[model samples]
Target: MTTSTPAGHARVAADAPHGPAGGRTALVFSGQGNQWLGMGRDLMAREPSVRAVLETADDVLLGATGWSLLGELAASEGESQLADPAVLQPTLVALQIALAGLLAERGLVADHFVGHSLGEIAAAAAAGALDLPEALHLARLRGELMRKAVGTGRTALLGVDAERAEALIAVYGGGADVAAWNAPEATLVAGDAGTVEAVVAELTGREVFARTLPGDIAFHSRFLEPLRTEFTEAARGLLVPRPTSGRVVSTVTGTLLEGGTDSDYWAANLREPVRFVQAVDTLLELGCRTFVEIGPHPTLGPSLTDCCAHRGVTPLVLPTLRRGEGEQENVLRTLWELRRTGAVRAAAPAGGHRVRFLTAVTAETPPPALRGRQAQFAARAAAKALTALGAAVPGDGAATATVTWDSTDDLAPEAASVVAAPVAPGADTAAVYARTPGTDWLRLATARPGTGTVPTLPDPAELTARCTARRYVADTAVASAAQDADDVLVRLRPGTGTGRRAHLELAVRITAAVLGAHAPIELCDVTGYDDTVAGDRVHVARMADGTARTTVLDAAGRPLLHIARSAWRTRHTAADPVTAPAPAAAGTTEAAALDLDALRAADPATRLTLLTDWVREAAAAMLRTGVDRVPALKPLNRLGVDSVIGLELRRRVAAVFGAEISVVRLLRGATPADLAADLDDWLTDTPDAGPGTAPVCSAPGAVGPGPDLDDPADIERLLDDLDALSPEEVDSLLGRLADDAASEI
Candidate 1:
């Protein structure tokens, strides 16, 4: 399908089928040169159908080749026999067949099937022309015969059309022949090794790009003629053909297979060039507009697209898997695309588990008036919604209910409407929305069946130790706190009364601190407050939708309260003002005491400890937190320090320690301990420099020196210099100025 953008929104043209009832769909089986190590392993582990097919193939091949198909696929690169033709060919066929079975299970049934080169055997078996065993036997025999063929041929792909490739072969006067036409500008040629090498060298001289395929076997070339007789004889003994249940397009003859194949047909398939483009044209003529390539990787997609494009059609082409990517994710993406394009129908299970959508309340049916505060009203509203939707209410005890609010606007204790619907087809969960009477409905909450019992709580000490190891600052308000990645767990301060609103506000603040967010919190979901327990632990997990889910658990691990979803409103207020230190006088004992020379003269261990302590104290001052709470090894950003604050900290370091450090370095995920170590290293390597000896000027709006202190511009400069002077320096200067004034008097 073609993708276009109109009005800044992507639009995919569904020119093919709208659903299974619409246009026909075809399954395109891929051939060789696409296999990789660890291919199809994910599928084998996740899909029972795939695993069954692979295990069956392994059993089948063991008796025939005395080697395990599963073992070969699991082998590391160096130990793998996947490069062997005898192993790779059958392995590819088995994988393709397994993928087809998987698609069929997922409600995507093929109306027709096609294969390129060795893939034809799998296509035939899938179309019911041959039994699986017969097809697998043919694959084994074919691989064995091809591997035993006596030939010294090689193959290479060229960035040229089939016609130019033929011309080059003719001009070179070699025995090379075109093996396959891949795309409008891509072609494959095969010949004896020396001739193919010379042809590639000649193309390189012309600045034409060409790449030689790995291995020495020239498939779909005349080099396999020696095995033709033996393959035909072996196939004749195993031949037992029947009418296919589905259509099978042939790449050998480039048309639909009219009848069952014979030994001679199999022999011709072995020694003939792959007419992939022509077969694609036949599929297009037969009204198939959606093609799903079944293989470990997409080796035929480019060719299929090129062929379809030549006919002025942009057919929907999808691959079952790709190399160097997660196979399960790729397969799911393909399935999702197919369903989105209406090529497959999402099927529900046999039983009627689907929840019905609740109709919106009409003007005639006025809602009940709300009573009490938001928290109390919300609980009653949720119970009413569950009853209206014919759902069972969560029982008291360890049961919990999740409530999500779409808007943070305070709901008045007046008339309000509650509408509910199922989250998805065949889902047990229901989403409920609440709004003022006579207004549009927006989702406000969702409730699912709760667990009958409580879940075990994680060890608080273990979590605390992990937090300390990661150098995360703990919230003092929280009795004990810990963090793992984006998840934060904090115990409520003991003796705090169990107030729902108060607990929610505390949880939101903790989440905001860890996220480094300054915006107001929007409540998305809250759960389990029917039996509010004092001293509950709040656990907040960051969600993929930029929201956090906060759950409050009691000491016994039962969920006492839960906020299913909460998010920042994206509008930020001005930060709290930072308290600046009083100006220190320059050239005084106090200023000299803060110099780096003293730190440098100390032993390495003591120096590191001193610097680390200094860093912690400075960071704490900047963050407006307790010095004990500042983590020595935690990243500055994780400790809620941003760029502006980092710059201020950098200036403070220069002023206090007489060292200049960049703001970028302070904010690049470096911890207080790391910065201390770096400073220690710098002090050790650098000699005593007097450039940073002067204390920084701290007067507000102060500038540098000017021509005269009497001038308005120079007055600010004089004030700045005075601010930089030590207490003793200031006293001495004041005495001298007083004496001069007395003499003038």
Candidate 2:
């Protein structure tokens, strides 16, 4: 297989046998170093099969480790967890197994299975020789044991042939061993720190490129001996490899494992070098023409490609999913390519096949109105459509344009057209449909096709209301109402009663639907008679000005409620919440209130304690509980502190600390403890935080309202910032401005 466009189908050789989904393909699982953040997340969301597999593995790993596997995958942290043997090993296996299961569900089956290092477990599971739960448990134990083993470093040597690579290791390896034969020109070595360094230094002296791999675990070397005994004993109970339809070529032995891979075999697999080249060659010898990496990302693709290249033959190589690319798109693209290649032919499950029918359905009538010709044309078109739909045409009652399907073996067309005989507007076809219960459906357009363009109205968020009741109702109902160009109609649900409040809310909802906004509404002027109840259709006509007049009508067409000039002022200025007055000079009382230098000059530990207390207090305020109720170590979110509350807490923290804190950090930190730790570290490290140092604001986008408010430049700058405020923020700014103006008056 060759690389295709981002959205292009996977490409296979024209002559290859159709692989599984109908093409011949082999599944290869990558070892560690292939996992990354956001891996499999998109796929899990898009594909039900993939989600099922991942969710199942999540439960299994969570049960074994008391941590969520999916959570780790989605976390924003870097490769720290991936470096942990206990975490990375199980996660890699889980990702690979899930990808394999996803493909199988889409009708793709692997002809051969191959895995590198820890990936062997995933491959074994894919071949049906090992149970998933058993594999997960074994992977976790293996990782944990290996982590406990004594080792320090691992490195890969490049630009050296296989012979020279082995010779260099034998000569200067010190205590390190060749861990993996990744490619003919690339070899991985692992051992204690000094030995690994010695090998790298010697290789550099010899002019052969060498670099240390990520993480310090000396996998596949003598360092893992400590794990072998424990791993073997544990595997004896869980590693029960049974017969499988697909073959699993062993990288440890450089050949196929006969009968089945036993517990002892898995134990040794941890300490042996991965002979990936030989395994690839063995798979080719077994007639495998396509190689697909079944993991989060493709780390083995280059190595396997080199292996095939060395054999002087080209093989189809693909990855199940790659970083940055959507998982479902990649799978679908590959499947499309595989179908094109004929390695596998697409086939649907029994009774799941579907056929769809569509018609262009032109509408036209001339003065002549040749009824006979029209009928003949309609019949001919219907027949052609039925043939295209793979549906049987009616013989005796052909005048009805009928299609038929057998209920047992054959099912109805997945898509069927619902057509109605043309009728005048407002024609009551309801009675006719009531009589014939099986009628599919029909739609009637009241206006003629060539009618004048419909007038339009501003969305509900645009206009302001004059009546308070109307405004309140409008704001609440705007989200649920149905509005067209010139009119708005809202169907009150069954629960709203004929009480005074309900009637007022309905009037507001109707008025808001017509005028758009709820604020600045003047509702006290209007008086109501009877209340409106549920099932009433509230209609509002959009007036030329921004305001609207509303009427609530009962089912019988009698007016239930009315409002005169219910909508608000036509040209109201929206509030600007974010705008703030220019800051007074440096010594202003507001600026002096939050003096952080004294706090910073205090002992670091005392400062940290105080800061922690502040966080607790802020969290309590956000949760609307007493400070004693806040959990200092738990994440604030777990205590029902929402975003609004979190923002308020952030504001409080900024005011008290007189330091700018990152909103991102505030949101992403694992818990209050994490936030407190970060703040403490920052305070301790910041040199300017000491006494006698001039204070500076560090909060993002908060350089504002400084002590030089009278300066023209400061005033201009403040206004510029205000211009960037969102509509909600602007509204808040306007409210603050109104309060300040009232104080002055």
Candidate 3:
């Protein structure tokens, strides 16, 4: 797993992969300030649908920033740029949405959301912390006030090496000062220029030059008091929603952000340690093995990838791979990654019966045994036939093959002498050798075959890999358990041979029944099955009832089917290489299969529950945004749902919650009026994401003059005027008059 690292850089830690508590984890997001030109260009180009989102962002931003934003805005006011902090925050918001939308389309999402300075706003937007427009305005205000507060302050950097960086900062000036390490190789030093310069002069040539970046402004330092105050005032007029995810990691320390409190996120975030390493570590500890940094310059990309490679973890950063190449690459990568993480591959588990290979009895000493050629052909042919009968291999189409030899020991007791096939080194059923019948096997002398065919087995290696069937998955083991269970359970259809397909279906049913603890059972597998000899004793011989009764009588003519063996194990011979499925069980078979309509007709409560699930699933698939989905929000809201709860419910209940539908359309409208108002806000909020334009729709019908002057006569006079005017003229003139009145005010 050794990966190339940037040269001249010391290994952060030699033993990175050796984490104490198993691993680490972190949530990361780019704030508004970090956005640059070509930010989402890569993602936008990939998914043409996502371009609409970018267009929406341009509609919300542009011309407001008064700076360059990679691409021009699609607005009539061509002069305006969206680089303004206020507008940029929204731009970042839109970018994150478009990114999330693209990811969802392919099925990728995150375990948590984390944000840096302005990035916190985008993070909030990502987790539904605030709507798109509000997030933009907040980020813009933060940037503006922060710039105002700092007032051209300088952040003198000492060096990129953590030790050198810290030593340089300390030697440079820090006495009562702070030391914030951004990464192993980067640190941000904030203070007065004279002292900073003095310290730099003190520690000359120990590291890279004191670069003395211009816009230092002591970002994330206490110098932004005025900015914090202004930002707070602005935040009050806004309404932020609950985060759609569980935790929002604070970039300050890679810890959880305190909800409803911006003091910690604001003050400490600016002035505190940027413990990104610790945050990443925490995420890895939380069971997140993959790291995905979304969009833009990818400044964080190198740091993140280096960290993961150093720590022996996987890093899936977007836009690197995509940025210059354009949106197409970005979108495709996002979709593919999302698909890797987001979608569930439904599997119909495996099934196989246990044939205890009697280890003690060997063909070498006594019992006339089938030749090696005979055993191989019988087994191979039977396996091929079962595969043809619809036996599902793993999704990979390659089965987990396990090899073992049949012994005569389980069939009849004998001394523990050399058997046909010696136990493989790691035989799971090694102890059971005493009970198995022995037979010759191929070059698989190193492989310990399982007792019987396990439908759940991945490859043959799995049987020895697990101790318990439920804890492990072997189609053969569980099916064996079902076959050996005390209950007769149910019967198989007459004239139907118990073939490979039948055993596989039975394995699925049996595993589901036993592991699921026999919850109302539902089983269906219509594929036909064929196998080599499936039983050592029993045969589908005729009976007095004129039915194909299974009997186990030997040459002595004693009934073998009625003989008391719990599970029927398979046997092999050259002639019986292609064994048919066992004949259907002798007696009572299943009456019929259950269908949705019949289940729906079962009980009222059950029916509602089922129908409700169906409706929710439908809603998930047809993800809607803006006005189109407004009507769908009320029912969700009336259910008393919150965003986090809604997300959780969808994950737990809905099959397609991974679709990532709009929270706006799925909530916020308790009534049609509320929904319509929500839609109007969505439409208008697009343009007015700045200081004066917000609080859209003016809360329609809000009495501007305090209830029409509260004069009955004034109302009467207005009515009289309306009556005197022609209806068309009154309507036509009304709009103009209102505009004039507002302009005058």
Candidate 4:
């Protein structure tokens, strides 16, 4: 059968032997340096298939390392251990495998698979060359071995061809070698730290773009040779040779896997240089045109584009997930792109039997009595109905009950009936349905029997050690002890109110703050709620499954309400377009004209007052709060100004007043009054300077010591820090530095 293809794509026979579009689809997996703290979280909450894969991986990793893989992924930015190779390697592999599984379930199966560096293990698993458990084991062992070599060497990416990279490495010949040939102009060099740094310095001096990769260990180089024997022996016990279901492009050998992967092959994969460009060539030769990157982010898209461009072909490159973007949206977009390009056949609807149940109040139309905890009550009603239908009841162990809210609408309070039915004839999961009295039943939520054991919670003292517990309102509904950015413990105080909606809302707000979720709550799974009392504490921890678990405990610390998962729904609309504001011309606006002469003539006390008022109003605008609410003495972060907001405030200051305030100072407990004092000092010291003059401290004690520019490592660290700043902040900083240098001259 033949089908029409989208414009710019070629049509192909649907029944082709290689694939749905005759070897046009390939799944690419990226290795390290692409992972972030909250990757794969939304998929775990929305896709049951992805959750199952993650759960299986967590089980395998926990048994092997006595640490939960899910726990690490859900860690707060401040508490994250993702930078450690021992943790990151397995985590990336697990996430990649989960993404591949999700894509396959969506009918976007690939005809070929390729992986970069450590990503090959996941690619092998996805290609059916190795079982999931064995693949995870191999990844874990690889990470452990790699961790031992940390700090011994470093890796650097230089904008040069492989030949040029080799020549440069030879110039500083201290064991540095070409690690990976990413593209015609992108080559990775790695070896001893000093040698690599010397090479980077030389290239940088010659204006060639050279950057040191994040991790300290030099992967795919002789620095890893010491680990070969141990890694091979360990891998030998876990990996069994098996044929791949799909063609596996080998980066290490730069060829197709003719037989299969074994212990020695894995050993070579660890130590040998990566021939990524060659692997891309092999895929191109096989006529693969659509590349889907299955990893945390689109780290390989540019390289893939570059490699394809070299062959005079423009391939469609898609990313399964992107850093700081919605995972569900990204994956769905990729799937759509695949179907659009005719690389995957269109999916047919699979109709199935669904069980439904009645509820007192659905999430969409919750009554006043069940306002905030609608999902909790709805799940309870559904579980009872499922039990009546002979479904398995969730036990009070580590296992949990899964609940999802389908819709939201305000309806009159009633004893709303629910229809409970199994998702499949004998499936453990069941769907709950509800409707208004005269309307058809709408799917409300799904309940699934949870597997595995619950994690142990920290002691109350330990949990509250670094946290400041505060009530949601001035003393009204709920008090929460936010432990870092990913965990919160809430205590339901007595005599607050009869309604529990406030408590639930407070918990949701705190959860959103920690998880950085801006979506509305749509579904929640509750467990361990057999009994409860006033003053019971609710502990909510962000999970790797892209949800937060709320565990209610009594004063003595017994579990009362265990909400295993709370899912959020983000509303996307094409009508609501975000357009950037046009840049203002220099000195064109009245606000930009700072009266330097008037400011220099004013007294110190008056200047401080003027600066303080300006700072307060600017902060209020950025914080989206009333100026009255922003106290002059309180720190900006204390008034809900996070790192992102703090950067915006800095940009505003730079744009309007032509002054650069340090973001580190803004977020690290600096008050508006403190900033005003700094501005006053700058005005007093640089009286003859214009508005854009470099910032100067009247007192030497105003700023902290600067980094030593002579030290390359320190310079690198400074540059990394600067990279996090906004473009305006960088411009302001450079202007200030330039003005300072001119004044010295």
Candidate 5:
């Protein structure tokens, strides 16, 4: 497939090998403007592997930009300002790259890869075309440079074809440029803010439903040309030559990246229109039967579908994460679709009139973090479901029962329950698709444990309740995986329990069963708690090993679950269990307990020498450098003392000398020697005496001896005393103190 804009950038030929031998899957990445505050939180909790990605990203960004990516994600509301080009560009790249690693852990391979806008950087990194650090550095540089371009912005016009969009720009753009050819009916325009707004007004007047995007600068437009030279120079050190691995369909040029990724290619990519429609078709021509959108949400799923339709192809489009879906469940469901379609085969067979039961051991205790958290109740619910799975007898009549995990139970529930219910052995069954009815969902509910009360278990008949049959959540390529034939689809109600709103934490544990494989699993697409209770049936289908691609649903029959799949294992081994780190403690040395009176009696020079030696020792110990090796006149950052370690230095000084200092002051002091001199002077002229010494006092309105204001605690106390006075009193005191100091000078 080939397409070109008026600029005649390039052409794409379907020359790459279609899908790999097993099955072809293309990993598609979403760019900026798709981040939300709670995006990958649940996934991080459920899968330590995903948590590692989040940690790495946080560390890298924190080191490079002095901003906490994780803190921003955790602190912001749903409508976070991650859209700032500076924040979003780097964040989006990190998110997509991390998600790609997570997906790879689930046995989902990308035969062909493509990215939209900044997403291309992540794709290159995922495909071995670029290293992660290099990609991250470039992304950070791109975002920072783009953020510098102010007064311009981007706007999108819906229901407008590319031709109509271009014509509208010519008519009302007033110097605006078409930024992207997003879809058959969606186009983005960028330029000066006023011009873009004017275009939006003109389009809205014509009932085109236009809106501005969340950015302050015009991207993919000529407005950014002024920054090209500087950006190219900075990007040169950040990007390496692309490798010869996974093929990446370039949305910038609408062709394959033949020479691999490079500084020049990325430089041009920054100002090029995203020919997304053409790029999708190009991947289709390359024989990628399955398309997976990897990111925080499903912004590109619809566009991918439309692109396939435009080309008269029926490609399987999947999303790794959704706005409000269970991340682990959705991923597992995708794997199920692949297995059902024979795109993937199961590791075991079932035919000997024997049903191999799969379940998590509920007898073990849940982790402390899970205790009393929202996911706690979910653990019990999964335990109940596992009990049912273990009790199932082949060819037995329908087993109808409700399993309730009363909050009063002292036993903590397991994180997840992976229970498999295969077809009845020796029963007549055909290779036919049976959509689970909605009314067939099981009803589970929770009650808070009463204070100091032990509750008796409810009767099985009284506890279990079945709802009227209903429709199963319609599959979206299993939502994340494509549907298949010759697959055994069964419904397991392990996830039907309900609890307090916070129990959505249970989403991670409930999804853990599907991720219980020898290889680590990565979770994507986690759901947030809404008021509505999810009463939909949980669908399960074995993909490979003991792994089952499962989906839990809301009352509305929407997929509420998604999980990644790893090689299934019948036995369990916690090779990597999540645990909290030990807390740090401050210790006092004999030097710290030395008498203040001794220091006060010493001469100024002697005191200064002692304080300088102590300061040097503290700095050396904290920085792991020799006392002499530590620079006395250089900034702490020069010795790699980041903010985290700077604070530690402050603590060390306080512990050793009973002298409190602020991290800000310690870091900003001219040098260690200068700071020590100030501290020594304060100690020698102690205002308030220790138990064995007399107080050193001057006249009532006199200046305190030598620069003693370096003590943060003393400064704080001074500020507090000043605050207690009336405004007039404060002014009068300040005037008197200033006059006394001036007279002394």
Candidate 6:
């Protein structure tokens, strides 16, 4: 099949079967060199009809065959299978055919078909060009014979002039040919490895590398002409079918060849250069818009896109080879997106075969991360969208899927009793081709065409206040309230009022760009609230015990916050506690006035690091700095000689220890978190700890005033809070909250 564009159009369409989502005349299949191990193995297991075809593959190849090519290469670092064309051609074919079968099994049919040289045979089989047996037979003979022509194998060069590569090959190495000029400045050359290496060494200003491959001969280059004649004779024995009634491009010239007998297909392919570049141009001429690479690898995709870029035409390349577990699901999903955007006719799942799915979506078109011509907006969009759907699908065959979102203000939750909440059950397979959900934060825009009742503010805050992952309640309530005001319902767990901080608040920014409004404001804090008890939204608590009253006392008069979130909590226990010791006093009053730096400087290398760190920490204490970025300090109770470390530091201080001038004392004239500023200018400092020590775990992004109480009084208050944590009810609650987070993941 060919791609099409207006006579004077600036961009060309790579040949794809589905053409554009809206077109009728195209056939899509991946090219050679794209196989991975185990690509079609699943299909074979699931569909005996498919397995029948792979069985023939076993008979067609020798050592390291196509069966080993598809996905096995991906197992470890530095392992690849881009070498053998014989294995590559068929291995790629296996997966594409499997995908095609899966698609066809569900009635997603195709029309005209064509493939780059090695892919040509697979395409022919797909388009009735050859039977499975005949295709495999032809491919096997072609691979083995090509292997005989060039002993060490070949490589494809991209972003370089095919002509230049050929010249260098002829001048510096054994005879070689520019086998396939896939695109302008993109070429594939094949010959003896040593010879190809020599030519490559002479070239500069281009990216050139060997693709993973089996040690086989060059199939498309002139070096294989001898085998070509021989293979041509052998191919004559098989009754090659007539080229499909519709036009089919010949890799030899990268253009359509008309009215050729069946044998001519084999003859032309044998003697001609793989004209991938010309084929891409022809497709562009044919008015095709998008190209979907069927299987194995998206071999020609990079080239075709580059080809278009050369003449200023940029198009997308969809490789079926990269699809995950659900092949048909991914293909169908891509088709739907194409249809939604007006590329193809809407091919919705009829029914009964749909998989229920829920997904997190963003309304931001081409979200900030996916920008530019260098990338395929449509392809990336399709990949992202489909993958999300896949994520929300349950492994237990649950027809329902749910999606969560960063913003849920507009999302409305079901009432205490609402039947028939819609579950995600889309047949879109884009998910199969999407990046693993964990690898990237792919956000989708959740804009249903018509709206019933999205979500509102007060309700969301009430819901968020239910989960206390965030330690700020009023903050959570306010943010949740804002979402209510803005009509956004976030996709997350329901709230539970249990937390680490007395109050936990999880807040993020939500801006409305699509509905077009004035400047966007930040929705500060969102708290998880529980509804199990007196119907109150407990905004800032880690969890609510199942046994405890679900009704919260806090939200008696407050509106429910409907933040579209899922709720979970778990249990945790405090480790045994350890006590700290006081710093040692200096020997003499004069010596006690020495600075900490001088004291540390006198220590051996090993002792210096710890003592110096303590001094800086003391400075931070003076500045009242709190909470560390990295979780470096082990819990005091976990250390074997916890007090010893502290004692050693104090002794180091006492050695050249400065005077016991409270950092808080100096801070009366200075600022916080920077003792250097309020650095004692009077008597040298000593390690009794300069004063005003900050508390640990002071929540992220907190900017607040220090305690009004004095040192001993503040310490007493802290100890009291720690003691309060032991209250049976409080312990039970924290236990449940911790449990919730663990349960969710």
Minimal lDDT window, size 10, model 6: 569-578
Q: How close is candidate 3 to the true structure, as a TM-score?
A: 0.39
- Candidates 3 and 5: which is better by TM-score? 5
Worst 10 residues of 2 by lDDT: 356-365
What is the TM-score of candidate 4? 0.48
Q: Write the per-residue lDDT of candidate 1 for residues 1-745, one digit (tens) a residue.
A: 0111112112122364322334668899888778899998877854666888999999998998899989987899889988677888888888888887777655565779998888988998878787767778888888888777546588999888778888777777757887876666777889877767777888888999888887787777778777788889988868687886439988887778888887787787788877777677777766777888988888887788777777666577888888966575466556645654555444422353221101111111111111012333354455444433343323344344344444544444235676677777867677767777667766765656554344343455555555542222223234555667656677665544355444544555555534434333344334444345664676766665567666666676555555555555321112221121222344444235466777788888778888888788678655644354687888888887875566567556656655544444454587888778766766776656434653322222323322322344544454579756543334333434444555963
Clashes of each: 8, 49, 83, 13, 33, 145
Candidate 6 clashes: the total is 145
- Shift of residue 475 alpha carbon in model 6, Å: 42
Question: What do the candidate models score in CA lDDT, each in turn?
Answer: 0.63, 0.55, 0.39, 0.65, 0.53, 0.40
Error of 5 at 485 (Å): 29
Those runs of model 6 whose alpha carbons end farther than 4 Å from true positions after fitting are: 1-25, 45-91, 105-112, 150-158, 167-174, 192-195, 205-216, 259-261, 323-333, 346-745
Q: Rank the candidates by TM-score, best first.
A: 5, 4, 1, 2, 6, 3
Model 5, clash count?
Answer: 33
State the lDDT of candidate 2 residue by residue for 1-745, as single tens digits: 1111112112233444322223356789888777777787777654555667778988999987987788877777653476677888888888788888766655565678889988989998988888889888878988888767644556555556556655666676457777777876777777767767776787788887888766667878777776677777887867565885548888887667677777778888887777777777677666667788888777887787776666555566777787765566566445534543455433443466311000100111110111112222222222232233222222211111121111111101212232332134453211101111344432211111111122232233232221123211112122234544545665554444464345544565445324434222222122233443343556676556555556555544444544444324211122211111122454444225444566567777666666676577557544434354576777666776654455555455555544444343344443565666656665666745532332332223334433434455744555579656433333234334444555964
Ranking by lDDT: 4, 1, 2, 5, 6, 3
Off-target runs (Cα >4 Å) in candidate 2 are: 1-24, 78-80, 205-207, 347-745
Q: Which sections of candidate 4 miss by over 4 Å? A: 1-23, 347-745
lDDT per residue as tens, model 6, 472-509 = 11111222321222132233123323331111122111
Q: lDDT per residue, candidate 5, 1-745, as tens digits? A: 1224423222322453322223367889888766766777666655555777778878888899888777766665654657567777877787788777766654454678899998998988888888767877888888887767776666555567777666766777457777777877777778777777777888789887788876577878888777777777777766667664548888887667786666767877787778887777667666666777888888987788776666555556667776655565555445544433434333222232211111111112111122223234443343333233332112212122222221221221223222322125532211111112232222332211112221121122211232223212221111121112312222333334453221222333333332322212222112222324543333344443444333344544444333222122111222332221112234534443565677777777666666666666566555533354465666555665654555566445544454534443443443566657656655655546333332222212333223334455644565679646433333234434444555964
Answer with 1 or 5, whichever has the higher lDDT: 1
| lDDT of each residue in 357-390, candidate 3, tens digit only | 1111111111111121122222332233233322
Candidate 6 vs. true structure, TM-score: 0.42
Task: State residue 416's C-alpha deviation in candidate 3, in Å.
Answer: 78
Question: Could you give the C-alpha RMSD of every candidate to the true structure, in order shown?
Answer: 25.0, 26.6, 28.4, 21.3, 27.1, 24.8
